[model samples]
Target: MKTGSLRFANIHLQEGPIGLLTSSLRKGRLSQTYIFAGARSVGKTRLAKTFAALLQCLEPVTGPDGSAEDAPSWRPRPTSDVVSVGSAEDAPSWRPRPTSDVVSVGSPDACGKCLSCRRVMAGSHPDVTFLRPQGAEIRVAQVRQMQELALLHPYLGKWRIFIIDPADRLNESSANSLLKILEEAPEKVVFILVAEQVERVLPTIRSRAETVLFQNPSHHAAREAIARVTGRPADEVARVYSLTEGAFGAALNLAAQDLPVTGLLPLREAQVRFLEDLERFSGQVQERVNEAPSLEAALAVVEDPDLLLFPPLLASRKSLVRGLLLAESLPAAFPVLFSRVFLDVLDKARKGLDKVLETVIARQKSAYAAEILKEMDRQFGMAVQNLFQAQVVGLLECLRHWNEDLFHFSHTADETWLLNLDRKDDIMALSLVRGLGFAESGIQLLSRSLELLSRNVQPVLLLEHVLSSIGGRTP
Candidate 1:
């Protein structure tokens, strides 16, 4: 294994799976299909790609031909102990040898410098295909296309590879189509199905493929791996590690940014300010509703908060109405436009934070000489694109944390689990005012909104719906 190779270097904390793969390669016992099951962002896909590259590498390093003595560090089990692929056995139970018996070897790996390896890593090899969800599914059409391609011999490599990412996203039709391929895949063809939830995969498909489990690395291990890659301070890497919820890929991305970790301070402050405003406004609305004599009067009082009295009300009814139209359906209390004001405040805050980020990037750029300014500008451009999304994500994360705290606190009556300890009084008051059901529902709504955001749904609509539902829920 070449340590300098991206294929090897990028993989973290899956020595067992890697050793099994290398052993199979060394013994010429590669399975036609494999199910790499693991949590998202845990390098299953990365290892799959690396394996694909090795399978097609023009200069692979499989040590002395099929000789156990050549590689003294590890040895395969006897034939009697090995469950042959496609045998009448559970996929999960099939193991070539105990992982403890398999050790890492310096051979049976891709020469990442070879042309075939480079092409595979770059995702340009004709024989290597990556099938991902086409707008939320691996459609039947996509699978059929892959089937056609799989029939052909390797265009320029030793084996043809098809990697289906998030294989659980395959709908019934597509999954059945893929099942057909797995049943009788052509010689020299490899199918790697990467799924986060193996249970969601079809039983037939799971039964056909040899399953390789990839476990999530410990946080401390992840922090050290990311630090080694990013060469940043341990504290900074740990902070990014926690912020990304132990997601290795996301942490690496954040660490790779040229902007210092402290550069996010302004963004955090802005999010905190916006959230505070929302909390304060929610309290005021609840107070006004409590004072009203009837539901109608309460709606009227909350919606028509006197701008003179509440100097911080930044959005007008017209703006609120415009924003509400973005949502698929008007919230139950459509007339309660006060909640929409928070959206306006959030927009202003985002724009202000954008400026602050731009200034920071500019200062960083200034440190570079003119010759590299073009490269710096390109890097900053990418950073800017990520910054806008990060800002929205950051706000949503805050809300998510708050909602989670509320839900857990309601269930357990424990303050230790609360992420925002400073907001204990507000959380307690809201819990009392809204009840447990609201907290649960709020978490679901936030979760759905976050998922939609990832799918490129309009952020404006998501924000509008969340604000209206959470802030405008009648007290």
Candidate 2:
């Protein structure tokens, strides 16, 4: 969350990898290629950038012993304070200050004030390049282009750093091309491949690189850090931590958005009340089934609209879902009621999309022609579709957690292990009614739905199938 500086000391809870990289730099054993592997938002990319900056720093801070130290925290200096490292004609005649006057390199950190350091931090460095997925995959052409760039000398720094984020996104041809570069990488060129799921990376590429694994900080550490940064109550930050499952980046993002932690309490209370109503309704349905003269009557009783729909609960659930979506902190174990909420959003967006497109076209028509307008409309539609798909994926994660809780609670009866602690009674009742088999089936269904969703299955159909199957309306 700290801006301006990318020093290793500023990074939270990544001491091991930081030490390794800094030591390697000090000992002149730095690897040409490194795979920084970790879960999403655990500081892998930040560390990569920092390392790159240090490698290319004009006047890297080093200790008396010629090793990097835990450097002092850096703040952005005025443009006048930035020390330029350029050609002799334009560069200032500079010399290193005495060790006592400079920061001690106990292991060397970037001064973060030099022209090279500033450019790298601001993502404007000519020699530093970041390669991300062009669409869903990093294409072979990108790697080929990078290969050409690699053959060139560093533009303005000591090293040419190429960072491929989510390196697992490299498709087969691209990965092969990257492997060739790694095999015979040019001098002073560093390739840092970052991956959340390292297993997805090609075996040859993984084998060629030195891998540094990053782990998430403990919940307590993460909560304290987030609370300190956001200046929010520890208790409030704790709730946000739980919602993000201890991802520091995600917690910071939610805090930046001023997540409605207090409002969540009311949402939970509403959810509990709705579940109680549902439990009671289930009892009534059972009684009706017992009294019914035939299977058709019993089935009709179970499917009644009044029994299935709780209008007040639906309204409360919709508001809560929308708020969470806006905050980008939708809770794990988000209730199954999200199916109805998602359908509602889908319907509204479908109805309004054409009108929204027309408005955009009208505003742009003076500047763009018919073909441009048509292409813009197509892109806008794709963006909306991608947004809807992302929402479905988020909801699927929540349902996955819900089903996991059901499975665990059914086996162990341990509320402490459950993500939805507030929904204990509801989960217990549902577990008993649906049984362990249902929980297992629900988990499988959600997992499959997620996999299918990645293959471009219709989001609406996926939700409908999941809701119906989970509700015992489908086999």
Candidate 3:
């Protein structure tokens, strides 16, 4: 019930995959193999270690009485710091008391004063073994050695524990070898396999062990921790938690700094500017398609995928979706031509979406149309800038092909297009916004139109003449 007790109490196990492991433990029927799966930094490895410690703790946990509790004085370390374990004589001292904080098996939760705890924490525990690859992946040799060690009797405690920090990192041969042992694991021997992505582990391995899933702490939990550690006001802590995307470690790092966590100011400013420019020109999108640097600045804000920054390209689609939704609700006289054109641009933008952009999809409905358009414009503009002149030329050509399809839609007729003449005129005003060579033609206009766009100059005057010729304005 203490502030940090839930951290180690395995309370999160009450729900999700972690709950399965908790149920098994309460029944005194622990699985020989267990996989802890989740995203990176979401606490899979951390939970695996805690489960291992609980299995080998000298003191019986007081909960369900599946096992008798050890006498008082054995308690787990509240953090990730490991407690080294060496021998059986240290067993009595190694017992860890229940804690709210989640601690790994190798962490200080083992009571370093005990011989077993000291050896394990120091990475020299005889009965405790760790099998990890030396480089990019875990190889078969490591698995072979593990097999050899697993068959041996424990040198100290009643049980021997093996922890594979990144179990999914094992190569095919190594995984198969480990799976063989799991199929026939000895009594009193436990294997904890920690994986960021469970599906990557072989199905045979997955089927044998109990699975535990750990979610990152909630934003509220992170904010509270930040306040406690930094003595900062709740408002500042709340702000930092928002910036960190609810990551506990990230929030803690920022809170520890003497300065406030407002370093993201530049990013915010660039996002704001990009959005403002987009909205101001939503009705004249064609003229402003070349703001590359500003576009790059927009993408940079959410570079860290876990933080879930909304990218410019995805933002564009959201804007179009909103516009489409609005168009559906508007009067028949309202022109939705610009929204249609913007939607065409968005359909093509999805091809290069990064993970961060995909995560932002859920927020699209809540985002403003103008804001989405701005982000997309910025990203597309920047992308065009990065390409060679010829590549950019080719892209515009492709865009033109897509644009030509729009004219055939029944919605582009005079009656519907006239109300939004200012926006429609800009498109009609262009020398050529359609047909086979439209990409080539579009590129030619880009340089000239971009300059005019930056100056806030409207070239739609000519568009009005063209629309009038087609009876668009009179309708």
- What local lDDT does model 1 show for residue 36? 96
lDDT of 2 by residue, 150-188 (tens): 999888986778999889999999999998988777756
| Per-model CA lDDT versus the true structure | 0.60, 0.63, 0.45
Window of ten residues with lowest summed lDDT in model 3: 465-474
lDDT of 1 by residue, 19-124 (tens): 7787675454677788899986778888888988877766555333323234222222212144243323321121122122112334466666789888887678
| Poorest stretch of ten by lDDT in candidate 2 | 75-84
Question: What would the per-residue lDDT of candidate 3 be over residues 1-475, giving only the tens digit for each residue?
Answer: 1112112342332245455554454333455677777765455654555455445544433432222233222222211232332235533343335433333321223332355444554456677787654444677877888888888987776567898868978889889988887766676578888887788899878877666766655444545656775688876665444333344554455555444222222322433443443433332222222221343233433222222222232233222322322222433322233323333333333233332243343344245466765645455444333221222222222222223322322224442222122123333433232333442433345444434433434334322222122212122
RMSD of each candidate relative to the true structure: 16.0, 14.5, 19.0
**What local lDDT score does residue 171 receive in model 2, on the 0 to 100 scale?**
93
Q: For residue 156, what is the lDDT in candidate 1?
A: 90
Index of the highest-lDDT prediction: 2
Q: Where is model 1 poorest over a 10-residue stretch in terms of lDDT?
A: 92-101
Q: Residue 363 CA error for candidate 2 (Å)? A: 8.8
Question: Best-fitting candidate, measured by TM-score?
Answer: 2
Model 1 misses residue 356 by how many Å? 25
Model 3's alpha-carbon lDDT is 0.45
